[model samples]
Target: MSRSTFVATIEPVSTCPVNCEACPVSRRDIEQPKARLMSLAVAGAVASRLRHEFGVGYAAFGNWGEPLVHPQIVELLAIFKQVGIGSLYLTSSLSARIDAAALVESALDYLDISISGVTAEVYNIGHRNGDWERVEGNMHALAKARRESASRLKIGLRWHRYRHNEQQFDAARELAEQLGFEFKPYFGHLGGIEAHEDFERGTLPQSKRRFIENSVFLEYVERAVAAHVGEGSCPQAENLIIHSDGRLLHCCALMDSHKTGIDFLALPRRVLESFKRAPNSHCGSCLAKGWSGFMHSSKVDHRSPAEVAAELAPSSAS
Candidate 1:
């Protein structure tokens, strides 16, 4: 008999190394709870089952927390690789300590390093309590690992823009390129600054509406941002973000109480079907309050995950 496990966008640890002005978890200034890391045994069992059923490269590793903070991360990855899981994908704040040797040797196929500002003061404004030098050092270390291993790992950096840090944009992009990594810039969510439920109303609040209108971030990633949110937003009613535990949230951005997700493993197929079929209350703001777009959840985006993976995978053409 097989001991069962379930696949999810795993969060091995529920801790963020750096506090940001826009992150909901970090906004609790008074008596915030400590971070929670998932049980390695639980993660291993799920990964094994997914590997048995779907083969390698079928799961994503990071969602909300810093996966690098898990003390046994190397071993955790080794289990998946042992079972033949392919192309582990993860994104991080690059604020956590990195084990370069372990990371390069593991199953991590893709890593997206997040940066908010280019200059020290400005970068700290968003990254709060972060050290620019340390982040830069980690970036170099990751690049070094890729070079030394002659590995197939792909690394990229994303800069989430804000009004205060707009001046540092070009410099950061240039630095990322010089470091031999892809540089992407996008506008960030403003809802985290207020009550998490505020955005759930599906319509913009006057303050947030005004902020979006004047934000420097809007000028940089207008089209991309629009595609993901606001008018003509991409429909993601089927997409959900899963926590280290089995808890799920409707949209990646919404973490409030209204749209409580069904435990993925408790009724895996049913939950997944529900996840794939309809829009929930939590996604209203992300769809720009358009009920019509919400109704389009079952519509196909015309690309499957496998197709996306193949596109990103190195060309096998000879």
Candidate 2:
């Protein structure tokens, strides 16, 4: 988020192929203009700028959607390598092809597979319409690949925590360890999890709630140290968050069209300069809370190709 050290977060697609019922994007009413898939040129250019110019060390290929779903995902990784990106991280649901053989041989630094429960029925509560059988099969494939390839990929089975699935942590961890993968648990926002107890009761305090309801500024600092994400003066960020379509995002959590700010494709240089000058207002706490007294925003496709081309084309506006 700062000018000194920046990281790149890209969502290759707004819509995921898997229909996880609890996923916010699965809400049929939600709509945001998303790229059909990340174009090779855009991926290459962004990676180059961050690595060659800004000296970024890593590029995470996922944010909201599954990164592996990209048709050219491996190719995209090649772009990062080509541009001197130091490392790569990928997060996926493992609902589709989990070609472990290919993955173990790739240049990825980390691979996180999100799973909520161990059993098919239990996993379905969070994953919704998921196949536990398929997950197990793919994980075995991954383990086999790791054994054969001697890969150093930091593979982990990320468990999204919920009231029901919390009990399965031990078995899940054991399974992960057996398969040469670490088992991690995290509270997903979609499970309606929050950072505080105030969310559950109807009487959420008005004062502590001002950050989202009335957030003043996104706190960003380089080399400055502090405590939490809500802490402003602390040097917290390592990357410049952006959508593949070119909106310079405030953070990975808030991707809704309204929340995303600046069209980077049209004014790449200008947007970079603007973010350095001004703190992001749409991030940190939140600004999209509604009748439920909770944060919510639903838009992702923010590319403006026509405008981007106009800027690059030989025109007087340039």
Candidate 3:
């Protein structure tokens, strides 16, 4: 991401209680201490930096953590709004105990829900921490709240698919349609090829492997990828991510991993500039041919979730 505009993404926590089947990283995977709530003071510190230094007008509370888990999430949103950056976008698994009405009342422009499947078996297979009945109930309540409140908050459904639930796409899409939300299909890579070599080798057929690696699939999917990229207006140009340790980063995707790039908060702006100016070879590896392809990397980069909510100015209906 180039330029100096700030879009601070705060990751106050990590890992889901449910250990999904396709997930490469769960709360238990990290050897660090248990996920704890971020102190309001820490949130205030990052918010201060964002407003004063970066002129960041957008704040998103989801990245590595299940954002809804924050006890004062509503207060945090109110603080951002009080500071003139309330146009926040929330990304969550909807696993927290908060009410959907409260989330809708926060005046957040976008409420993106991570949903794996509709059926209990399929959904539970990928979302170990999820309860189909509970999520369904919450989502229905959310939709009702949106209608009654007449809020412009747009709800989005993101589905992470793998071999286990590949057959549930139709049902997933139907659920999204039923909810009047857009559905995004994400294919997850189990990190390094060697890490999940046995799993991948066993699950992905030769034909599927060919489709993913083939140049034709890449070309076919690039069109849709371009459209999605265009909609977000390239996050790389306007995004910034703030880690719980008080470090700011160019992209949330790069967070927790030093191999992606330097931490902007820890380094000089010049260093960030130099890093962004350097080529991102990994982007080339992201061909966007299949679901997993998009999850990998891609040439079409965009702003961070923070920047997207701020600069992109999500639609009132979003």
TM-score between candidate 3 and the true structure: 0.66
Candidate lDDT values, in order: 0.58, 0.58, 0.58
**Candidate 2 residues 100-207, lDDT tens each?**
677777878898888878899788665665677887788888888888877788897876654455457677778888988876654333312122223334333343
Flag regions of model 1 displaced more than 4 Å: 1-8, 29-34, 49-57, 82-84, 191-240, 257-261, 266-268, 275-279, 284-318
lDDT of 3 by residue, 106-210 (tens): 757888888767778767655766777878888888888888887788998876644354457667777888888877765433423222333335654333333
Give the poorly placed runs of model 2, Cα more than 4 Å off: 1-4, 190-230, 233-238, 257-270, 276-318
Best by TM-score: 2
Model 3 stretches with alpha carbons more than 4 Å out: 1-4, 22-24, 27-30, 191-238, 249-251, 258-318
lDDT of candidate 2 vs native?
A: 0.58
| Cα-lDDT of candidate 3 | 0.58
Estimate, for each residue in 203-262, the C-alpha lDDT of model 1 and write its tens digit. 544444444444433322333334444554433433434555655555544444214655
Give the number of colliding residue pairs in candidate 2: 8
State the displacement of the C-alpha of residue 152, model 3, in Å, after optimal TM-score superposition.
1.1
Q: In candidate 2, list every pair of residues with a backbone clash.
A: 6-239, 7-238, 7-239, 7-240, 33-301, 34-301, 256-299, 257-299
Of the pair 1 and 3, which is ahead by TM-score?
A: 1
